[model samples]
Target: MNMNKKELPSLLLLPGLLCNERLWQNQVNNLVDICQPFVADFSQDDSIEAMARRVLDRAPEQFFLAGLSMGGYVAFEIMRQAPERVTRLALFDTMARLDEPERAATRKGLLRLAEEGRFIGVTPRLLPNLIHKDKLNTPVADEVMKMAAELGKEVFLKQQTAILNRSDSIPTLSKIKQPTIIVVGEDDKLTPPEESVNMAKAIPNAQLHRIPKCGHLPPLEYPQLTTELLRDWILQEA
Candidate 1:
């Protein structure tokens, strides 16, 4: 028993900053019967490299990997660290470049606010960027704020720091040889769809999918379609 692990199509999912297992709830529930699914813990780590290593240490010998936003950054780091272990890749609502100066400045401001215990400035205001404007008053909006609140300030700071420290992954985009898919929300203002286009263009044999009426958090904003895209991507190579 100690020498043998179960043989299954292991799908290891790494969630974005401030996102716990709840982030991949829909995918986890839907894919469990089809494969061995695992949601990674990134809250304890302050660096993307550490997060990648942690996932590698705990993941199956070889698995399909999907990550959203900051998790996408971690996914790139994973490829840089251990490309041999990732059988396929799905990058959703993410970019491969370093943050713009203004974006970095915004992150610093949020870090300062978190350090001063002023989380209110970050949520509702930051929430809109995470979802479509028309859904501003919906329960989905409330859920996003609630999740961030529960994750608290420390995790936020760690995540922000990790983003700040992330190098330009653009240089490595062409190197990914796995079965890759770049999915973005048509209305995603944060990472935007253009960046996803660029990623898909750079990666060999990578496919791009855009979720309609969706924003940055595609998995939660459009669960049904998100799950469908993932299922299709998984089956493409199977």
Candidate 2:
């Protein structure tokens, strides 16, 4: 290991549903100069509490924590479970509330498809909901599909179950003492920018940013911008 690398702070990143380490590959590679980034494996757990516990068990004693979508749910659990260990918080394309009836129904329907062995991750019909319309034909869309396919059905099942059962985190937002940032894609249809707005308002001194023409998976959809945003957040004075 490089001696200087030891001096860098740890940055623990958690990915969303059907996403693996590949979801954060760009940020991991680009942010190496300022922080040691670690992507947690969220595939084994069937609940957010269990996922958060698994991450806390393996994460550094103290570190910066960031999560996207389903990962955001786990991040909230981590804060509740071990707030002292998190130096800062960053939420991307996620919300603090539990699923609405319509959303829950959609998730349940997808779960049924997977259970029936008909899981086709991130198909063309679903791409619009996950990314900006302009990116539908781009490599970014391909990467999203690739990630889903790579993680496959079992991981999807676990993630969906965890998300479905996650707690309502809005009430706990004001209690977060860490310097926090909430980011969302301007064109994000799933979580939407409004969700980030509500989170920013709830968390004390939290900063909110909306990336234009992007969607739920900003780290992959706009890697350079996402890297810069994270780099700035990591270096910002608390």
Candidate 3:
């Protein structure tokens, strides 16, 4: 099942907050030649567990799974439900910790705003925190704004509320024995490198990699690194 072989494992990419399939466009295109990659849809589900179930319901019998930010939370739930089904794991710019009280409170506030038809505020206020200081002024900011626009107010509220209530999966990482990769952007502010370090240490057989000059949305900010690491990790496990 190594890279030396031709039949690579299927890869399922889960996007971060307020994102859809467009988030993984670069990864999809870059890795399509090496392996089959599908972007999981979570807009229909309002809870992390339910989202995981929805994705699993449509996933192949067995394959590699990867996710970012909130999607990382769902990926862990998938691991909990169908550990035997995952051949490999990759988590990018995500944390293994549960929502602390302060974080939960912030999420709730954002959820409330979204519920009140404030999707516009969510993007501007939140996007800066996700990326590095320099990126806040670049085209990346415009891109993020455009993506958030696609999510709409209703989806924003649902996703934010779901993140506010997500369960702690730090303890579950140790139980996962598959070849796992923990990726973090060097410039990500939302989920710091410390978070990825903790996740790498907790997950069995996991390796951590950093994408320089990238932010929380590495799949979009540095798609080449994301695709290369994902491809390498899945192939190494095979």
Candidate 4:
């Protein structure tokens, strides 16, 4: 493998909805020894295709890729557009199907709240759904809220729009040959564990990991474990 004088392959981390570089800050800092990490700016576009293009424009020629939640949607789109560029894949708390009617309606309601200026960031009603119930008041939970709040309205709308219009990626799954890992929280109310399992099953040579006591935001709730898992995933095919 061409290391470009770097010790390990480049790893591109795509954050979920309303997330920023801070989303992968931990992994970036922790995995520095094994990978040259870059976190994508997902706020620059309103469609998954556009977002993938932007990220691809800046990413290394080839890299390991990871996406969580909404990022997973964008990941699938990226894989659709450039399967050859991806060396491996890591999907966390994500799904390959188009949004369910109920979930789409819920997203519309949240977007409505944002439009009405009622709640710019993720609101209290939605916070509990994001983290494990026991961790609702933890620092990690606060950080997630802070990230959402700081990203604010424009970003929220753009991401939600991208997610709402994202294609059902199941058709593309069978074609993914990269070494992949699907990670999810056991208590994730948003995407749940079964989705990760199903996604792992759909992708060729994919692994599945369930973080106990975690919720939608596993990176925040289990930063060290998540980072470690990601590091291992990167090395699997290296």
Judging by lDDT against the true structure, name the best candidate. Answer: 2
User: Per-residue lDDT for 1-238 in model 4, tens only?
Assistant: 2246475789888899988888788898999788888888888799999999998888878888999998899899999889999989999999998888998999899889878887658666678888988887678777888899898898888899889999899999999988889999999998989888888888888889999999998788899999999978877644
Candidate 1 local distance difference test against the native: 0.86
> What's the TM-score of each model vs. the native?
0.94, 0.97, 0.91, 0.95
Q: Clash totals for all models, in order?
A: 0, 0, 2, 0
Which tens-of-lDDT digit does each residue in 1-238 have in candidate 2? 1234678999999999888898899999999889999999988999999999999888878899999999999999999999999999999999999989999999999999999999999898999999989899899889889989998999999889888989999999999989999999999999989999999999999999999999899998999989999999999999
Ranking by lDDT: 2, 4, 1, 3
Ranking by TM-score: 2, 4, 1, 3
The 0-to-1 C-alpha lDDT of every candidate, in the order given, reads: 0.86, 0.92, 0.81, 0.87
Backbone-clash count (model 2):
0
Residue pairs that clash (backbone atoms under 3 angstroms), model 4: none
Best by TM-score: 2
Model 4 vs. true fold: TM: 0.95
lDDT of 3 by residue, 86-177 (tens): 98888888997887788788888777766666647335667667776667767777777887788778777778878877888988988988
Higher-lDDT candidate of 3 and 4 = 4
